[model samples]
Target: MDLDEAFELVGEFGPRQKRLTAFLVLLQVFVAFQSMLIVLVGAVPEYHLDLEEIPASREVLAKHVRFASNFTSIATEWYLIKHDAYKVSLAASLYFAGLLIGNIMFGPLSDKLGRKPVYLTGIFFDVIFGYVSAFAPNYEIFAISRFFVGITNGGMSLVSFVLTQEYVGKSFWALTGSLTNLTFAVGIAIYALLGYYIREWRFLAFISNSPGLFFFLLSFMLPESPRWLYSQGRTAEAENVLQYIALGNGKERLSVKLKQCIGAVKKDDSESGVLSLVKHPVLRWRTVILMYIWSGRRKSTTAFLIFAGIACIFTMCLPENRGGFFFSPSILALCGKLTVSAAFNIIYIYTSELYPTVVRNAGLGVCSMTCRFGGILAPFVPSLKTLGPSVPFVVFGISGLSAGFLTLLLPETLNKPIAETIEDLQTSTYQMLKNKKVNQLEENS
Candidate 1:
């Protein structure tokens, strides 16, 4: 009896498992909601500065013409000029900064602390900071609030994601993966609709942040990761959780499952620290490749939508004088966005499946922190208009393309057993692939 047997006895894709996965999928929706809410929450309405006299000549356009949104952002309250990209998008940038910090810190913490506690703590802060941002008196305070929200989002999201993947069978990861894409799409569409209906920024903030509360409440219902418990040499608790799972799953003879778990439990020889990722030999190359993907920042389903948005913006607003071209920049941009998004979704799912359980969170965290840096830079992209509108898009496009090519270097994990330890990942997977090649050659002979 081994770990694989333990997973089997628990009943893969059983009613209990599906029920839990559904709830977890629901939570992923809110996580999607929380992440994308920023795009619309501070939509600034257009406005104009008071003019004592209208400008007679076009040369005076800079003085009289003030660029503004139809709805003023909550931060601006009054008016902001077009060139002030920092003021307009700084909160989002700061939030990404917080996300970066969260990614760096939470992975190791969760590995040390167990997934549930750190995850719950993140939810607590997520719930608290979420609402607090609505009442922010100034842009600076709002930025700080949003930053903390980003931190909780990054930390909890990583841990919770691992837990979600762990609870279900490997074959069903695709189902869960589809749920991730759907929720992301749903989150974006719903937020857009909410923005259209809701006029006040603070009201929108409250409405958007309300979902965090549900997650915190649901935190009580979530089971601690049995795998994490086992890894930490806590078989009693692991057995208890397994029993609970067996009962919920309507499987008979919990004793057999317990025996399997006991047989699988051992001294955790795998290095679980964040540094272990770079220090270990096989893991080092894996980390480097992962970092490349991270830097490319997962140009997937959700991200491509963002690119499509940029394309749409340019399509409507492209200068009338540039009508000589058959296809406008915006249309081209939109197509690129769609392609990138689909590719990203595929790559990101593959990334999650590649790492073993012990260091999965850590690997994901460091990788996502790299992504946050990209996020941090992303908000500032509008500022690049000073150089040229197409400059930013080109930069991002190159980044996405490079990442896709690098992703080919990674091994496929579809339907394969997810490794539970570094040794299992480095040694077992290596041998597994080696034996597979040998068997193929023997068959050919």
Candidate 2:
């Protein structure tokens, strides 16, 4: 069949295929929650030991903070480690750095290798490191373990975004994308519940990640992306995977319609290197703009949120202020963090759908990395507690508003067909901008 005829025929099957794809891709939400619980566990603790409780020595307080900074120190029941606040602060930064490195690696890796391997690898990495974290002998080991956890967590992060765009029909992509964040919010809620009961940080770490092992084992049954397979010229393999999806979703045995549907996609023989991302003007813009939005959002949001939480801790601790139980302030700070988490998800889901598939993974990676970079400076926020928590909030609020504006810069994909190739994106985005200009001119006239 001719290209026009092929597109017409494929349109009918695309929606149904997208349904199956949504179920498969949404599994990443579970993975994301499991990966993030450790961060929450590490970060959201009640600062209980009073200065009076420790010997009247600055060195002792510093030692305590350092001990707590170590993952194993967090697990220690006997020693009230005080001085290592800086270490804990640094570990938190490392956790985010680990997440940054993982996000950066997954994009190129997913582009080179197929999605399933990376997804499964992320799960396994989380599982192995998660268990190691539970039993880490010292703060140094625990700090290193958190970095590895970040790497695995990053892989888990991208697969869902990629899968949703690939499998779901264009119409459902935006809302489907948002659902991952909503589910992540639910995970945070679960972590909160777990935190209440599993006060022992080591046990909390173990329980939080235990689900990842199960998910990794379950991933064996998950099918690889047929679109990815087809893109690489593995036609038969793509067809085989698509057929299984059709059958799994209870469609009648693979019809010739299904075969012809995916068979129609053109192969991408262009080099899949870093340069490929910059080779085209449109693709290059998508990568950079998305990266900027991501970076701005993460940096601003994370920095402010971290500072805010530290302020709340100080408020709860000071007798001159509304000094109350330690958990009271920590809980309030945790509640405030919910807002940050919600904003991050909303922006990410919207941004992921903004770019076409040609640059989707690259775009998402840049955004994710941007957020991680923002998180890198998050540790320093505590130093500014004297300026007030609202200061950080103002910064994050601006970043969020800026990112929201950037989202407006993106062409909406609703009702529009998903762009599966570089040519399609170039034409579509060009015409979109052109139409907007024409509308502006017509309005002025």
C-alpha lDDT of all candidate models, in order: 0.69, 0.59
- Identify the candidate with maximal TM-score: 1
Tens digit per residue, CA lDDT, model 2, 197-279:
66667787778778777667776876776656655556577656655555545554444222233323233545453455688
* Model 1: per-residue Cα lDDT over 176-259, one tens digit each: 766766676777777788878886778888888888797788778888887777666676787777777788888766664333
Candidate 1 regions off by >4 Å? 51-72, 76-85, 258-271, 297-335, 378-401, 430-445
Query: What is the Cα root-mean-square deviation between model 2 and the actual structure?
Result: 9.1
Indicate which candidate wins on lDDT: 1
Model 2 weakest lDDT span, ten residues long: 1-10
Could you estimate the TM-score for every candidate? 0.78, 0.70
**What TM-score does prediction 2 earn?**
0.70
Candidate 1 accuracy as lDDT: 0.69
